[model samples]
Target: MDDNNSFQTLTDYSLQVFQLCRLLWGPIETPKNVQLINQAYFEDQQRRHLLSNWLHQCILSQPQQEQWIMQNCEFLSRGLLNDCVKFAHDEGDLRLAALVHAASGSNTVRDILRHCAHEDIVDVYSKDFRRTIAILSGEFIVKGHNLVDQNRTTYWQMALALHLWFANSASDSVSTIVRDFESAYQEHYWLEPIAHHGNTKALDLRWKLLKLYTDDTYPIDNVFDVNSYTQNPFDYRL
Candidate 1:
């Protein structure tokens, strides 16, 4: 364990980031008055909040820093930004959420995408992503596309990426997102869920909530489907 960054250190670093995010957005402890803070607007206003710079400046040693960077790359690329989008919608701050949403396409995701050789396919994903899914049972190009789980084809990821890319550019204001979110939502509403089944429900919930700012509106009372803001954030849970 001497060579590795202890879990505590990682936890501390994560807490630091969380505090910074909360300070920019709102205090998590007293959310009743957190209001609809725009983290994106305030974040940009901060002198320099570059994750790259933060990675280097932190107290973590080089290996630890490298590890953190790798982990964070995936977090921002797949999770954090998406959570921000969901929170923005839940808090009625679409404009700010839109900013983070815009940032999601940050180069890392694009870089990961380069590894895929097929442009026509992204990964295999079940279409429309229902929580209770049927085994591809029969859609195999003609029928069970016959697998319990499938990654979306490159074409699927490409189309999705493009749609989101355009959505980012078109984001104007909270009011605009009322319609704009739907444009993005149309792609999300029924798109296939990720291939892994381990946390299928949570993953599905996440996607639903991510586009939640879009038209994927869940009933405000249906806490099961979305907006569990009062709960611990993903970082803290880890």
Candidate 2:
């Protein structure tokens, strides 16, 4: 279909879904109520899967219009967005999940990291790292707009994701990933709370060691072993 027709169809259907959501889940009028609503919605796997499929279709139709969908579409509640994020992850589309996380302000990206077992997280990164870095970037294009500066939370989480993967997995490109992360961190270091409660000194020391080790001039073994590191590398302050 043409762009205009596609946009109209999506908007209309989304509105219908929005109404249905309200009727099915009740009013999400306040923060407390929204939380309760999301909890209830989470339990409805059938509905969540349906919503996520529709969301995925919309995203495919307008790949760059995520912010437009999130800002203008009435159907996408935080609950639905979180469901989409989860769906993307389950489908092994981490890039789509990250984009939705950035666009919809969903906590599922961080939530997944926080809730999953360490082995599961390691498995995901090890398998996906060879294929993608869309989740690790600080900047993203949403609805044709360049969002050069993401929120502090998103930036920190992206860094944390990379750090965890790098710590646990062995790869030839890991040093490059470390360098990119350090650059992004330096660029956004002035932003509050990105490094708050994080062990900055340890991070700095590791960066240097990784650089040296990956350079092949020096051998640094077990420096980033996940088992030796703290359970929460960035700390629970987040």
Candidate 3:
């Protein structure tokens, strides 16, 4: 529980960074007088506001800070940034609900995720992710090549991590959940291409979010391939 750097409003960041955060954080809370054009958008804004408040309150501890950073790493690495944002927002809503309920001494998060629709449990990463859904639902005869390819590997990893994080028998550390599936930190052969594929603004914003959440030192070259803002290079080579 070291002191957090003073909270910086989204306005303090560059326009590109702010807009990217808007995508990650969802819409800001609209005024009560604002008429809702879309029910989904309204719900999103409300959830965003709630999660933001919850994070501001809960991110005071090292464990909580690590949890937030781990969540982002999983979400950011799983798919196209635009595709992942919606799922990330929904996951945050569920996490906020779970944490609130846990504080009140309830442990129903695991049951809710297990009994809900597959999509409710994790981001629809790809057809491969449908395999994860099947696995979670007790249909465990995995089909296809079962070979991890491209983002499919990350999809499986993130889905499992999310499940383990909120499960009734969940580990106390986010790193444990990662180790349960990933097992090691061997660099992927596709790292260079994956890094190159990421949008520069999105990558910068991801690093900014990571820094905001955790005080730990993660080499930027490893966390993000490069950002125009940093001019760092790919540091991980096979």
The top-ranked prediction according to lDDT is 2
lDDT of candidate 3? Answer: 0.35
Off by over 4 Å in 2: 1-149, 154-157, 160-172, 189-208, 215-238
Candidate 1 regions exceeding 4 Å error are 1-161, 167-190, 193-203, 211-217, 221-238
Candidate rank order under TM-score:
3, 2, 1
Error of 1 at 58 (Å): 21
Candidate 3 lDDT, 1-238, residue by residue in tens: 1224211222233443444345445655556877878865565545434433333222221132233243433332232233334454566644433333332233354344344323334434444343323333322222322212234433222333333433214223322333333322223311221221244433433334433323356454544434533323452221
Clashes of 1: 24
RMSD of 3: 16.4
What TM-score goes with each of the models? Answer: 0.25, 0.25, 0.26
The lDDT values for all models are 0.33, 0.38, 0.35
Alpha-carbon RMSD, candidate 2: 20.9
TM-score quality measure for candidate 3: 0.26
Choose 1 or 3, whichever is better by lDDT.
Answer: 3
Clashing pairs in 3: none
lDDT of 1: 0.33
What does candidate 1's lDDT look like per residue over 87-204, in tens digits?
A: 5567686654554564455644333333321223424432321100121111112132311123332122222332333233333432242344344334443235332223333333
lDDT of 2 at 217: 57
